[model samples]
Target: MTIAYWCVLASCLLPLLAVGYAKFLSSDSDPKNYDNNNPRDYLAKLKGDGQRALWAEKNTLEAMPLFFAAVIIAHNTGADQATLDALAISFIGFRLLYIYLYISDKATLRSLSWFAGLACCVAMFIISA
Candidate 1:
């Protein structure tokens, strides 16, 4: 399979993995406790779900265009297999690291990971261009 294809697959799979991890992290309390009527309870649940969703949304917003741009540039400029693979893997790996750091609430580490992923995306586009 092509590098772009793999990147797309990874993009789709990452959010699902994040959701699963979030569910795993949730407390083993009664479902009634998740009710939307109570402001505090609802806010708590929203906070937890929002973190994961925000991370996924940010990743998706940043990654998709880069992935597509890489693919298009690769096709246009005849980029080599290794270069394409490296770009794809870098994007995926950095995104995973970003998710981990975000979930762990490591402020500095999360910021670093986010910056690294953004840099990787820019670098990929620059290289492809």
Candidate 2:
């Protein structure tokens, strides 16, 4: 598979990773009362690191569709594979940094990282055109 395709796979996992991080850090919370079927409420009750992880998961989930669209759209439109691969790889790196920054409570840097990743998606579309 192409690097861009691999990036798509990696991007897909970020939210799951966040969910794990949130749940693990939230061990203190009573799982039985957590409204297991309603994760939003459960995550909302988390504090500190768990809260941070929850938000990171939310952010990653929000970014996933755009990244997927960028990769698929670029490929379908016959954009240069090498260029798309490079941009997609960059997007993955930025997303990783974004997750780390979010977990570390570095809001400004995380926002910047999110912007960079979004830029990558935007560039992919521009390149395809």
Pairs that collide in candidate 1 are none
Error of 1 at 104 (Å): 0.2
Tens-place lDDT digits, model 2, residues 1-129: 889999999998988877777875554555566676887787777887778878888889999999999999999999999999999999989988988888888999999999999999999999999
Instruction: Give the poorly placed runs of model 2, Cα more than 4 Å off.
Output: 26-42
Query: Which window of 10 residues has the lowest lDDT sum in candidate 2?
Result: 24-33
Q: For residues 3-93, could you state the per-residue lDDT of candidate 1 as single tens digits?
A: 7667868876777666545444433323445554663454345455445545655565666676667666765776666776776778788
Top-TM-score structure, candidate number:
2
Candidate 1 lDDT score at position 87: 69
Per-model TM-score on C-alpha atoms = 0.70, 0.86
Question: Which regions of candidate 1 are displaced past 4 Å?
Answer: 27-44, 48-58
